[model samples]
Target chain A: MPVITYRQALNDALAEELERDGNVFLMGEEVAEYNGAYKITEGLWKRFGDKRVIDTPISEAGFIGLGVGAAMMGLRPVMELMFWSFAYVAYDQIINNAGCVRYMSGGLINCPLVIRGPANGGTNVGATHSHTPENFLANTPGLKVVCPATPADAKGLMKAAIRDNDPVCVMENTLLYGDQGEVPEGDYVIPIGVADVKREGTDVSLIAHGRAVLTCLAAAHRLHEEFNISAEVVDLRSIRPLDEQTVLDSVRKTHRAVLVDENKPFCGVSSQIATMIQEHAFDDLDAPVQRVCSLDAPAIYSPALETQQLPTADRIIQKVLAIS
Target chain B: MSVTRAEKPKKTGKNPVDYAKAPINADLTPEQKLGFLADMLRIRRFEQASLKLYQQGKMGGFLHLYIGQESVAVGTLALMGENDHAITAYRDHGHALVVGMSMNECMAELLGKATGCSKGKGGSMHFFAPDKNFWGGHGIVAGQTPLGLGIAFALKYKGLKGCCLTYLGDGAVNQGVFHESLNIAALWDVPVVYIIENNQYSMGTSLARSSAIKSCLAERATGYDMDWDIVNGENLYEVRAKTWDAMQRAHEKCRPAILEIDTYRYYGHSVADANAKKYRKPEEIEFYKQNHDPITLWENRLKEEGIADEAVIKKLDDAAKKEAAASVQFAEDSPFPELESVFDDIYYEVDMGTESGKTGRHFFND
Candidate 1:
């Protein structure tokens, strides 16, 4: 096993996929010469040259739709957005074109496309730049939404997304990009829509995805150390074809659950998880299911306000304690 | 020299050079002329049958008849190679027929039967046949513009010698994505021919009321530094010749260009809006039908040139009607998709198992 940062894992996956398939090309604003706004695509342009590592104009709708069209024409295009929040400008392309093309085409065409970039709040970049759109994208039937919480999962899922015949949205977080974790050396892929139980416990299950998985793990550690309570942390690496059976099995084992998400509470990812648990494992639960989510309001620009608005380890611990 | 705050730039009148005259090239052999006439008549007959079926409650959802805009699709698509691709907005039945989609599959799609081009998933507004290189029948206005550009980008990327012909309505010109697509297409030199089928009215509102610039929609291409030309869409020869030139430029030079085809729609926006009298006068519809019908114009030309006599024209008309009725019968005979199939095709591979377990991929058909 080798340790690598989450950004490096993404870069490695992209580099490997580009090397493996000549048709797989990366395009986005500031991705080529600028080394990406976040530098996740750093040194790829130098490695692959201009044709494969294409730097597009600052037009999300234009380039994303182009990627979908290319995918239809038998080319695998990996398109990047500066931030997932910018996807709003190109929502019609992503939601209408890429998401519905295969179904609309009667399976005659498949958009083997990956639209990846950072998609979380914690950066103090204000409401416009900060958006967790996994819930919104997951709502679309033709799309696969994956949010990996670890470097290994990021690397594996990115490769899987590129290889999949359908369109897959890879939702990354800015805060988690720098976090380092153990990743396998050879060609590996953690399949999408599978949950990883980071910590095993019998008291309660803390289910989360993406960055919220980190908060859940931290909360699980504190629950065991301070309160003598063993909390299970289930990382839902993929959101769309959500691993419902795994979450239900975890809930059935612990008989208590807390759904944690960085997205707002109303009609959010946490809400969906909590509903699933209550619907499937109600009789097995010892207490009511709790949710730790961001406040239902626009993310403020101020550092303190933003920090208070998002979910944290303290919030997950409190939810766990409440249902324990 | 610094200018004062009160010094204002002088306003000038519209430039005369902005109004460039459209090119005219009406040179066609007797065989080619007859082919164009037959193509336009087939679409006309298909649209006529579709209109009748909707009235009899055989189909559900919106039915947009490509009645008057036949030449735009038939002429432009005549230049496409087998490898070339095309995409268009909701006014797409004509384009599908022109791109060689069988009338049986298209009618089945309209009827929501399992044997449709889209397997009963996409209805009239979303018809697609990628095998024929017809990308789709997009519902959202101007939605296919960027997708078309992407297809062209792929053609260039793969080193293919074909262009992507993307069609939009007159109203789609107002959409922001349409402009965005043009800017990128010109910037990257993507091989695409963006054909604006200006069918007089976008839905109910006429082009005069909807468009900001009154003179010509092709002039908008100048802003993006791309070549543009307007064509008499009702004239088969003019439409075909101009589009042929544009498509050649796209294929040979990898240049993106715009072609604004002046055409009209005889019916209302959709079949649902039968009372088109509310928007426009009956005489206006009658005027275009009588004077500017693309099928009639080509038929008269063939007769004048002694290419087709009354009997030959009658035989073609009879064959078109027969084929259209057969398509309707095929649609009515096709069965609906199975209930279990609704969950299929959502993903190419499902059942993605974790690293701890060796769960195999679950393909839909498997």
Candidate 2:
């Protein structure tokens, strides 16, 4: 095993997949020579050549649909959205064709395409560039939404996403891309829809994803050391085919649950998990389910406002300490 | 600077500027012309049955029948190969029939039966037969134009000689995505043929009531660095010949072309508005019926060619009616899916040892 950044792990996974199969290629804005704006696809164009590592002219809907059409043929394409916001232009393709084509056509046609991008707010990019889209994408069925919180998980989950015969939205976060972790070398795949327990405990179940998972983990450590809350941290790797049993089991043991989300509070992942818990594990809960979430406001460029709008490590700790 | 000379024009009475160079021979076999007429009559008969069903209260929802636009797809798509892809707006039954969908399936779809083209899931505006490469019966006005360009790009990437025929309303030409797709098509030289089915309304608004630009809409083609032509939709031969003229160039040159087919709708927008006269004159409708009926024009051509006589035409019409009836019966007999199927077909799991991708799966279990 080699230690690598989360972004490098994604790049390495892409490069390995490209090297393994000549039919697989990459396409997006700045995915070639310039690597990627996030440099996750660095040195791929030089290694794979222009035919495989394509540089598209900033047409998200056109090129994304082009990838879908190509995937319908024989080629496997990894389409990169420069940012999560670019999806607004082509949500119809993702929602209507990429996701629903297989089920709607009764399995005659499958859209085997992967759309990977950096989602969730942390780097102080305001408003349009800095909103978490877990709920927006999760609301639509027939698409797999995977958000990796670590380097090894990023590599393994991306390979699994690319190899699977369905459309997947792999969301990486700006804050987690630089974090380093041990990744098993060469040809590894993580199962989709399976949540992993990062820190085990017996008091409260803290469910989170993407960047919010990091905050929850930090809060879990603080709870154990300072307040003895014994919080169990669950990083929900996949959003759409969410692992319900693992979450409910954790809640069943802990007797309370809190969902740490990076998006606004109104209709975020907190609501979905809370509703599911209510439906499945109502009698097990000793206290009402709590949610540590960002306020209903845009992430303004001002660091102060962004800090206010985003879920912080301090906030997660406070939520756990107060309830404990 | 280049000479920048315009093509010569011919005198044809009303705004007659004829564009022809060298010699033009728009000829097909008499049998083939009859085949096209047979195709159009299939659409006419099926839609007529659909109108009948609507009257009986068997059909519901927005039913936009393609009563007068038969020649546009019949003429144009007849020139295309089976690999060539096509997409169009919700007023799409005619194109679906001409492209290869059976009258039975279409009629069943209009009736919202399980045996419909989309397996009864997508009704009316969302039919897709990928094997046939009939991309969609898209309902979102201009949404398919850019997607059509992307499909054409895929054809180029695979080195396949496939062409994309994307049709839109004259009203949809105003969408920003249309202009964006045009510029990209021009820039990349994507093999696409954009046909504007100009029936002079965006849901009830007329062209004059809406626009300041008063020229043959094809004139906008110059801005996109594309070759374009306009045709009388009533003349199937002219519509066919002109669309092929543009489509063939797109194929050979790998560049996009636009063709505007100036047509009229015999009925109102939907079946419910059959009596709509606030927007159109009754006399104007009658004039078009008498002069510019696309089906009648083809019927006359077939008689002139002496390839199909009245008995043959009658047989064809009778066969269309029978086939449509059989399809309705099939749909009625077909059962809707079980309740659990609603959650199925969502994600694709890797099944091993098939013709699809394999060999690396089944490695993990805990």
Candidate 3:
């Protein structure tokens, strides 16, 4: 295993998959020649040539729907959006076509497509540019949504989503792109819908996904060092095919839970997890399931306000203290 | 810098370009000619029967009947090679039938029976036959535009000589996605023919009120530098000839084009469109039925061309009526989908029993 940035891990995964399967191609804005807006697809266009790494006009609706159509025709298409927020213009393509085509076609058609982009709000980009739509995407039954909190998970999940025979949406964080972690080189896939317990604990469970997982890990460390609360950190890597058993098992052992997410509070991912906890693990809980979500408002444009708006370790720790 | 003046689109009357102008139908054998007539008759009968069932309350949901525009699908689809693909919007029963979907499955789909093409899932608005290179009957207005472009992109990607017939209505041309699709189609030279089934009205809004055009809907292709033509769709031969040229440009040159098929609908946009009769004059509807009926026009052509006698025309029509009636009976006899099937077809992995499917709880209740 070698330490690598989350961006490099994703780039490696994309390059390896493109090399492994001739059908796999990358198509998006500035993916080729420009080497991607974020450079995640750096060197892919040069390595795979124009056919394999296609560049498109800034038409999210056109390219995304094209990817769905290509996938329907048995060619795997990896569509990239500069930002996940831009996907709003292409909602009909994402939700109606890519998400519902398989069900609409009654299993006669499958869109083996992967739509990946940075879907975070901490970059101080305005509300329109920064949208965390993992919950919105996961709400559709046919779509598979993943959030890679670590470099290893980013690499493995990208590989898995590319190989999977369904449309998978990989929600990456621009803030976490530079974060480094141990990622094994070559082909390996962390199966979708699996949770990784980042750290083991006994007193309370701090569950989260995406960048909030890192916040939970930091809070878990501080709690053990300062508050003497041994907090367990659970990273829900996949959102749709959620690893419910792992979540419940961790909650059962800890006897308390605090759900953390970057999504807004109303009908958010944490809200769903809280309901799941209350419904299934009611007896196992020593205290009610609590949530530390992004403030219930549009993403703030001010850097400082946006930082406070998102779930921080301090917020997670406060929620943990209240529950523990 | 000197700027070149934009070329104006050719202005034409209700019958713009005639079947006599193209004459691609000259090579067709009498049997093939009769087959075209038969195809139009099948669609007309199918739509007529479905409307009756929808009226009877046996079929629920919006039924977008393809009554008057039979020749557009039957004629244009006749030119498709094995590599050619077709996708259309909600008025899709015509394209589905033209591309070889059985009336039984389509009728069952309408009636929400398990034996339907989409296993009772997609109702009347969504029908698909991938094997026939018929991608789908997309429900969204111009949502299928890009998918059609993608199909062409895949064909060119695989080094195959194929093109996609992406059909949209005049109303769909106004959608942002269609313009985006047009831009990409021109930029990439994807083999896609955007066939605008300009049946005058989109829902209750007439074309004049819905779309602002210089000459025809296809004239919008000028902005994208794509080739385009307007064709009178009432004549099956005219549609076949003009569409054949566009499809050739796509298949041979890997170029995109827009072909506006001037046609009309006898009924409302959908069965639920309560003001279908109120929005348009009864005289206008009667005028179309009396003069511009696609099936009637094709049948007259078949007889005038010495391809089929009156008896043969009657036989083909009778057979079509029988097939449509039998499809209704089959739909009535078919069972509804199992309750558990509601969870099926949501994911390819889950249905195929992949490792991801076996390991996790995909459905919420599960």
Candidate 4:
């Protein structure tokens, strides 16, 4: 194991996959000569050369659709949306062309495409650039959505998405780009639909994903030190092919649950998780499942207001206290 | 059979210029020319049968007929190599038939039968034959343009000397995605030929009302620095002449081109368009039917070139009619897809029972 930043982990996974498969190529804006908009693809262009690592014009709709077409033709294309919010211009291509191609073609076509980029709001990029669309993308049946909360999950999930035979969307966080964690050396891949219990506890379960996972971990530590509430932190690494069993097991053990997420409160991923908990594990609960989500407003530009807008350790602790 | 125009022959999308005198490929054999006629007739006859069934309530959803634009598909697809591909908008029966989809599968698909090309998931507007290099019958206008560009990008990536002929309609040219596709195709020099089948009307709106351009729709390609031209889609020989040249530039130089084939549609935009005849006059439809009908033009050319006679043409038409009729019977005999199949094909890993599929529940209900 080696300690590395999430950015380095993602770059290493991409470089390894590019060397492993000839059909796997990277295409996006500023991914080649500019390294990357976020610098996640720093040295891939010089390593894989211009042919394998392609730089697309500022045409999200065109390039995303092109990636779907190429994937249908048996080439695995990892398309980068400079900002996940920019995906709105290409929403039709993502939802219809990439999501429905396989189902529409009735097993004759396979869109083995991966659309990955930073989808977070903590950087004060304004309301437009900050969008957590994991819920929106996972709503489509043909698409697989994942949000890696750590450096290890980032590397493993990126590799798995590239190897999957279906369209997978990797939702990354810019806030956690420089965060350091242990990453396995080689050929490591996390399955598309699995959850990781970040810490084990007995009193209550704190469920979260992406940056919210870190928030839950911080909340868990404070809850243990101050309130003596042993909070189990469940990191939902994959969203679509959701690991219901793991989530249900954690709730069934802890008996109380609090969901933390950066997505908006209305009809967010937590809404689905709450319904699932109430329906399947209602009898196992000692209290009602509570949620701490981003306020139902657009991501504000003000740094002070924006930090309060997203889920934080204080918010998670408060939600856990109410539930436990 | 000629009728005089009441006005100065309304400035419609149809180009009155005739390129039939343009020389076709020298290597094109007489049998190949006859095959072209057969392919066009097959599409026309298949569409006629599908329309009759649609009117009879045998099919569900929409049916967009490709009755008058047969030559655009046949002549262009006739020039495709083993690696070349074709994709089009919702009006896709012509491209599907030209790309070797069996009439039985296509008809059954329209009828929502299990034996259909898409196993009854995709109806008339979503036929696909990846084995034959036909990408799809995309529903959204201009949605397939970028997909076609990507297919060409893949071919170039694999070092294959082939091009993708991306087809869109007059209405589709107004969509923003089509422009985006054109810019990328030219910027990357991907081997793609965007064939704008300008059928005069975009649903109820005419091209003159929907698209604003100086001379022709393909002229917009100049903005992207891409080579482009307009060809008469009525004459099969001329369609081949122009499309052949564009295909060559794509294959040899790996460049992109735009060929706007001046064509017309005889029926409404779809079967559901109740005012198909109300928007346009009867004289306008009759004029194109008599003078520029793709089938009639190709049959006349075959006779003039001594490639076929009246009897030969009648025999080909009879066989096509018979084939279309048999397809109807096959569709009638087919079964609807099973309810469980509704969950199928959503994910390849789920169907294959791979590690990811077996580990967790793909469907939410599970």
Candidate 5:
């Protein structure tokens, strides 16, 4: 085991994939000379040269479409969007072309592309710059959306995504990039659509993914330390192929559940998870399922308003206490 | 009485008429001439049958006929190598046919039969044959422009001696993605030829009403610092000549170019819109049908070159009509897909060993 930051894990995955397959290339604005806007692709241009690690103009529709088209021709392209919100500029390319090309082509073509970037709202980057589009992207039938909460999962899921024979969106949080976690040394990959139980408990199950997983884990710890209550934390790393069995089994054991997510409450991931709990493990639940999500409003720019808009550990704790 | 102020001077350089023209390949043989004529006729007949099928309520969804814009697809696609890729807007049946997609598959797709090129999942607007390097029949206006640039990037990335022929309509030139794609294609020198099929209309509105500058769509390439040429799309010889020059630059120099083909569409935008007469007069449609029809133009050229006579032309036309009828039969006879197949091909499967010590693969249904 080796300790590394989440950003390093991502870089390692990209470097390894580019080295492992000549067909795999990385392209995005500022990815080559600027070392990536977030510095996730630092030093990769020097290692792989200009052909593999490409710098593109600030045109999301142009580059993303290029990735989709290239993927149709049997080349694997890893495209990066500076901000997930900017995906609106290329929404047709992602949703219509990248997502449906395979199914539309009757499987004659496979868009083996990985579009990865930060997609969280808590950095005070305002409404346009911040977005958690997992719900929007996951709603698409042909796309696989993965949101990793740790360094190990980030590295493993990114590698899996690049190798997967379909378009996959890797949603990374800017806040979690510098966080350190234990990652395996080399040649390790964690399969997408698998849930990991960070802490086992019997009182209630706190289920989450991405940055919200960290919030759930903190709330679970607080519940145990403050009230002598046990809580199970389930991390759903993949959004599309949701590991429903793991979620149901955890809820059945705990008999109480709280779904935490950073996205808005209306039709968000937490709403979906709460529905799953009520549908599958309703009889086993000791209390009604609770959902802790961001308030139903566009993300405000003020620091206090932004914090109030997002879900926090206190909110999760409050939801668990009320349900339990 | 009112007095008017002096008018400001009109700006220059907005429209450049002195565009470059490519010479026709001098040694085009009789065999090539006949082949070109046959390809154009096949497209014309196929579209004619497709229109009739839609009218008979056999085919559903939007039916966009490439009735008059045959030579643009036939001439441009004729020059592509086996590995070269192509993508276009919704008016795509002609391009698909010229790229070697079977008339039966194209008709089946238009009829929404499971035996279609896209397995019937995608209707007329989504035809694709990746095996043959035909990318798609995208429905969105100007949506295929960026995808075309991406295909060109792939060709360059793989060091392939092939270019991507991305076709858009005159109306698509106004889209932001089209400008962005052209800029990047030139900056990166991606091997792509941006072909604007100037059929004079974007759906119901004419190009003059929709576009700000309507004279030379190829001149827009100047902003991207790219080479561009305009050709008479109705004449197969001019289209082939100009496209050959563009493809040569793409393959040999790894450069991108824009080609504007002056063409027309005889029918309404789609079969559902029978009000084509509301936008453009019937007389104008008849004029293009009689004077600028690509199929008739090519047929006349073949006869004038002493390569094909009236009998030979009649034989080719009869064969095309017969093939179009057979394609309809193929589409009508083909069965709809199984109910379970709705979940198939959504996501390709990959084996991922499970935590329970069993091998499992990820797919749509499972």
Candidate 6:
């Protein structure tokens, strides 16, 4: 098994899927020649050629809808959105058509399209490029949203999305692209709606996803070494079809739960999970569900303000200690 | 990409209704002309009943009346075949009825009934039937244009022989998607028929207020390197004649065509405003209904062509109304869809794309 960075994993998955399915192709601005702004699609243009790896005009709504109509005719398309903030431009197509078509058409048509690109804060891409859409998308019933902090998950999801007959929004954090991990060599698939327990303990359970999942894992180590508090860390991989059983199972054993997310405090994905614990497993909890999240402010270009807007490892460790 | 119209050599005779004036052939026969007029009447009556329901609150949302603009949809839709696709603006009940959706299904959609085209979830402004290749009763002013070309591209890629007719109001011409789709369609020769249903009003606004150029939407075709034609929509014969020429040329040349049909709106923007009548003048409304009545002209032509007598024409008219009434009754008798089906049809399957997340399917129970 070759160890690949998260970025290469995404690229390999895209290339392999293109090679796997003739009907699947990649199209977006700079996706072909520029190898994606994040280099997640490097060298794909040369391999797939212009027809399969298309470089479109900076018209997201137009191209997104084109993907939709093409998908209705059995073409699976993977579109690289420039940034998470710029998603507003394709809101009409994404919110109205790509996401809504399957339900609106009542199963007659399946929009097997994928929207993939950078999400969350990294290298100060500014407020426009940085966005955490877990809450905005989690509420939408027609869409399935997932953000992977590791490359293996990114590669596995993109390929799976291409094969599935639905429109998927794969939120890729630009910061996570450099992450290197052991990835299976051949056609290996990672099952969705399953959580990976990075650290095992009994005192408390830390539930987190995306970039925050790593923070929680690091926080778990600090609590074990310094505070002598044992904490189990769970990477809540899928945000939409949340693994309630895994979450509750950990909480049931630990008697406490700590949720973390890079999204803002109000109505964040962590807030939803906290609510779920209270609603589904209220009697099993010993302490109230604790959450570590960013301040409720639009991401600014200033590095300090930007850093202040994200959930830090220290904050996750402090939250875990407080609940302990 | 412009056309000179080779229809003049076909015939030279009296206009069907008037024996004194000689008619010049322009790609349409008197019988075809009559057909366009009857088609317009069908849309007119179909939407007229829709407006009545809107008044009674049986129909929901903005019920756009095609009372004065019947000729435009009737004219263009008459030019389509089995494979051609049409995507239109919110002013779309007329388009749906003329595109061959049952009067009941279209009206039931208006009434928000289960038997409606969208099973009542789409209401009036979102009816779509892929089987018939009609993409919408889309509510957004200019949203459907690009999607229309998308469907055209799908057809082209599938190697199906047909062009896509994307219709929008004068208001929609200002949108970026309209221009985006137009530019790409022209660049690729995507076999699309871009029709601007310039009904003189985009809701309450006039063409002079909205568009920089008031003459013809087809004139914009030159900038995109595409061909264009302007027709008097109220004159169904002229509309039919022009549409026939454009559709054939679009197919044969493997290019895009823009047809600007200049028509009028007799009622207010929606059902609530119809009685108010503050936006338009009585004389302007009276003129289109009296001089340019598509239905009356077609009936007169049917008599002149000796196709049928007065009784036969009346029978067709009565049967159309009866058909509409029966469908409306069917919709009224039907029940609303159950609420539990709301979570159905989200996707094909969860495990298929099981890498990132598990997706559930949400289908027809809506």
Ranking by TM-score: 3, 4, 5, 1, 2, 6
User: On lDDT, who's better, 1 or 4?
Assistant: 4
lDDT tens per residue, model 2, A1-324:
789899889998998899887768899999998989899999999988977898887878767776776676556789999988778888777777676666555555677789999987767777788767778887776677889999988998899888877788999987788899999986878878788888899999999988788888888888888887798999888876677888999999999888899877888877888888888899999888889888777777888778767887788887776676
- Over B166-264, each residue of candidate 1 has an lDDT whose tens digit, in order, gives 999898999988899999999989999999988878888887899888657877898898988876777777676678778888989999998888888
Residue pairs with backbone overlap in model 1: none
Candidate 3's error at B154, in angstroms? 0.4
DockQ of each: 0.49, 0.38, 0.82, 0.81, 0.58, 0.40
Q: What tens digits encode model 6's per-residue C-alpha lDDT throughout B276-316?
A: 36667888788877776657665666677676578877766
Listed per model, the TM-scores of chain A against the true chain A are 0.98, 0.97, 0.99, 0.99, 0.98, 0.96
Each model's iRMS = 3.9, 5.6, 1.0, 1.0, 3.0, 3.9
RMSD of each: 5.6, 4.2, 2.5, 3.3, 5.2, 4.4
- Tens digits of per-residue lDDT for model 4, A231-305: 999999999899899999999999999999899988899998999999899999999999999989999999999
> Which pairs in model 2 have colliding backbones?
B10-B18
Docking category of candidate 1: medium
* Clashing residue pairs, backbone N/CA/C < 3 A, model 4: none
**Each prediction's fraction of true contacts recovered:** 0.57, 0.31, 0.80, 0.76, 0.67, 0.39
Q: Which of the CAPRI classes, incorrect, acceptable, medium or high, describes model 2? A: acceptable
Cα displacement (Å) at residue B76, model 5: 1.0
Give per-residue CA lDDT, model 3, range B25-67, as digits (tens): 6677888888888888999899889989988999888999888
Per-residue CA lDDT of candidate 6, range A75-132, in tens? 7888888886777777777777777666665545667778888778756767777788
lDDT for residue B135 in candidate 3, whole number 0-100: 88
Using all chains and alpha carbons, the TM-scores for the candidates as numbered come to: 0.94, 0.91, 0.97, 0.97, 0.94, 0.90
- State the fnat of model 1: 0.57
**Poorly placed runs, candidate 6 (over 4 Å):** B1-38, B244-254, B274-276, B348-366
Winner on lDDT (1 vs 3) = 3
What class would a CAPRI assessor give candidate 4's docking? Answer: high
lDDT of 5 by residue, B182-297 (tens): 99999989999999998888889887798777667887888898988877777676678778888888999989999988888888888888688899999988987777787786
Q: Please tell me which predicted candidate would have the highest DockQ against the true structure.
A: 3
Off by over 4 Å in 5: B1-24, B350-366
Those runs of model 1 whose alpha carbons end farther than 4 Å from true positions after fitting are: B1-29, B350-366
Clashes of 6: 9
